[model samples]
Target: MLGIALLAHWLLGPPVVDFSHHSALSPIDMVATAHAEVKKPLTVNWQTLRELDYTTGKATPTVLNLLGTDTAVRVPGFMVPLDDSADAVTEFLLIPYAIACVHVPPPPPNQMIHVKMAGEKRQKVAWDPVWVQGRLQIVEMASPYGEAAYILTAVLVEPYTD
Candidate 1:
């Protein structure tokens, strides 16, 4: 019984788990690491974006507008491939979830970002964590679903590393 107790202590004691060490990262360190993961290049306010009915063949702008020319804003999001092929990235379904493309229908193209990588096509990293920086562009575009809607023009895309 004593030997079992000593073994348990050896495995689960302070020597194995040291939370009180001063060198341990503080809350501020974690916050800084998170901050480094995402950067806001440009933003369009919610009032400026014009929502259009994606279901209809005839494109009509909705009264519920959220983005415009002057209202700059930044939104954090993740990218999911529309197609099954990992390399054939014709379009990306942007969403708040790390794995939104698997089950979720995906955010509207306006809310979704169309990232155009600088220099070369952005390498595909883990899909879960990435920071997209770009300007919200209000323009008529046809989605892969054959619906026309406004889309955010993504200028840059980079993987978020901790």
Candidate 2:
């Protein structure tokens, strides 16, 4: 039954998540974990972190926060491209807000996610918001802009909706 369910999930994305049960880890856990009053995130927004610039050594590059450590997470976010392509993007940056890199100063690294589409999830995707389901790691992964705090090997990438 577990195998069948996993297969089905890979082939077809599930419509909704049942957050009532806490016995299993769901995407909701990521949000709840972020809002926990007691525990604080590893990297605060104000902290100045030094990282290797994609092209050359820059004096300062804002370090993204790696929260949740190694945990299962599902989140809705906008896709930003590390490698620009017309269609069938295998890897990209998934940020918290739409048009994140558009403004003069980019959003803080803590708000960004590094995602790699795997398996059936590697289909053609638009630059629209997407709900990415997978494990989120709080590890620094290098990119052109800076480092992405969260790295997700997406099992499911579906169009996001309210």
Candidate 3:
């Protein structure tokens, strides 16, 4: 009788869904659904970037309108560790280009994301590439080198293949 009950529960129980992390929503689709109001991951366009003040390096707040706000998203980028290590990182900057913050002048605010990874599972920094999944917040952050228009509290990390 116990065995039969267990089998029935296994077959009829609600599907186990992991609620601990963001769903697998593509960045592009997320933006499409947002319809320009702050709702999802938005692609940074350097071409239309509002030039920052050179002295203050202050970002024009107008771009903040395009921000994804407090929305879940996944983005693929190269890690630029702020923890000061190339092999491991807990806090880092994710940029559209691998050499973005390291070699050249960091791009404008919208072009980068300040990522504070969750927990002590320090992610191994790699030049290969990675996909960061988490809730994105539209906020301006200042660093010595550059500014980021958004910050993400990463919940999932995965190696990028393409």
lDDT of each: 0.46, 0.58, 0.65
lDDT of 2 by residue, 104-139 (tens): 566655566788876645546557877776655555
The residue pairs found clashing in candidate 3 are: none
How much is the lDDT of residue 118 in candidate 2?
A: 67
TM-score of each: 0.42, 0.53, 0.56
Cα distance off (Å), candidate 2, residue 16: 30
lDDT of 2: 0.58
Q: Write model 1 residue lDDT over 35-116, tens digit each, in one string.
A: 4432323343323332444454233343232344432334456766655668635456455556544544645544445444
The 10 consecutive residues of candidate 3 with the worst lDDT sum are: 2-11
Best by TM-score: 3
Better of 2 and 3 by TM-score: 3
Sorting all predicted structures by TM-score, with the top scorer first, yields: 3, 2, 1
- Residue 69 C-alpha lDDT in model 1: 49
RMSD of each: 15.2, 12.9, 13.6
Candidate 1, residue 125: the lDDT equals 35
Residue-level lDDT of model 3, residues 18-98, one tens digit each, is 222354546565334334433334443343334444345455664443334355567788887888777878888888777
Error of 2 at 84 (Å): 3.8
